[model samples]
Each structure stands twice: as structure tokens, then as C-alpha cells.
Target: MTTDLVVNILRHMLEQAMLISAPVLIAAALISFLLSLAQTLTSLQEQTFTTVPRLLLVGTLILIGLPWFARRMVEYTVHMFTDLHRYLG
Candidate 1:
């Protein structure tokens, strides 16, 4: 494969990863921030307090959206396989 083709594949992979992960990451960030704010207000600085809920929320979101994420990943994988000959040097 050409350097340009490799770069394009890398870029597309990164874009797909970001697209698949953005929702979970954003949810985690928001949950962490809100938990921190609550901890600040109540003086509860337990690590588990902040961590568990974030994990649960993000996990739940990923579970709920698993199908969509899988579909996107499968599409990318299928596209790559279909273009395998083009990528072969």
C-alpha cells in the first residue's frame, strides 16, 4: 500500500475510534464532574464515591449503546476487508 493509503487508513481508524468512544467519554466526564461538585459540597472525598458511579454510568451507557457501536465497528471492519486488495502491496 502507498504511504497515502496507510495514512488515510490510520486517520479513518482514529475517527472511528473517537466516534465510538465519544459518547461514553463525555458521559464519564460529566458524571465525574458532577460527583466532584457533590463531594465538594458535602465534604465526601471517598475515592469509591466518585469512581463507582462514573464507572456504572459509563458502563451502562456502553451496554445500552453496544449495538450501535458494534454496527459502526463492523461497518469499518467490512469496509477494510472489502478494500483488502487495494491495501495489499
Candidate 2:
């Protein structure tokens, strides 16, 4: 295992993680912003108002995106394993 190989592996892992997480994170953030805006407009400051919807939306996004996420993860795992021999030297 060389330094370059380790660095590359780490980089790929992080990239994959970011790619998989970005959609849900982005959706959550957008929903949070919209909820905040609604709260401000309506003077409704209930914590659940923001938290519940965000959670639901995020959950839904994860469920909807699960297949794509799984595929990406599987591909990453396969790629790492397939290239394991190259790093073993």
C-alpha cells in the first residue's frame, strides 16, 4: 500500500460519500429554508413545523433515492475490491 494509493482511496471514498449524501442534504436544506420562511410569514414558531416536514421530506428522498445510492455504493465497493491487488504491492 503506497501513500498515493491510500490517498486515492480516501479521496474516492469521500467523493462517493458526498455524491450519495448531497441530494438528501440539499433537499433538507431547501425544505428547512422554506419552512423557516413560512414560519416567519405566519408567525408560527412551533419546532415541529420545521422539524417534522424536513424529516419527512428527507426520509422520502432517501427512500426514493435508495436504489441509486445502493448502486453507487456497490460500484464503489466493487471497484475497490477489484483494484485491491494493485494496492497490495
Candidate 3:
């Protein structure tokens, strides 16, 4: 494959990764920030207090978003495979 083709493929992959991950990552960040704020306000320094909810929230987000994420990934994989000969040359 040409250098340009490789770069394009890499850029597309990164874009797809970001698209797939953005929702859950954003949720995690917001949850973490809110938890941190709550902890600071309450003087509660327990790691589990912050961690457990974040984990649960992120996990729930992942579960809720899994179908869309899987569909996008599958679509990308299918496209890649279908177009493999173009790259392989």
C-alpha cells in the first residue's frame, strides 16, 4: 500500500476509535469530576467511594452503548476486509 493509503487508514481507525469511545469516556470523566467534587465537599476521602460509582456508571454506559459501538466496529471491519485487496497490492 502507498504511504498515503496507510496514513488514511490509520487516521480513519483513530477517528473510529474516538467516535466509539467518546460517549463512555465523557461519561466517565463527568462522573469522576462530580464524585471528586462530592468527596471534597463532604470530606470523604475513601477511594472506593469515588471509584465504585465511577466504575458502575462507566460500566452502565458501556452496556448501554455496546450495540452502537459493536455495529460501528463491525461495519468498519467489514469495509476493511471488503477493500483488503486494494491495500494488499
The candidate scoring highest on TM-score is 2
lDDT of 1 by residue, 19-86 (tens): 99999999898998899999999998799999899989988998999999999999999999999989
Tell me model 2's lDDT, rounded to 2 decimals: 0.94
**lDDT of each residue in 3-42, candidate 3, tens digit only:** 9999999999999999999998898899899999999999
lDDT of each structure?
A: 0.94, 0.94, 0.94
Q: Tens digits of per-residue lDDT for model 2 on 1-89? A: 87988999999999999999999999999999999999999999899999889989999999999999999999999998999889886
* Candidate 1 structure, TM-score to reference: 0.93
Looking at candidate 2, the ten consecutive residues that score lowest on lDDT are 80-89
- Cα error of candidate 3 at position 61, Å: 0.9
Sort order, TM-score high to low: 2, 3, 1
TM-score of each: 0.93, 0.97, 0.94
Off by over 4 Å in 1: none
Candidate 1 global lDDT: 0.94
Question: Candidate 3 — number of clashing residue pairs?
Answer: 0
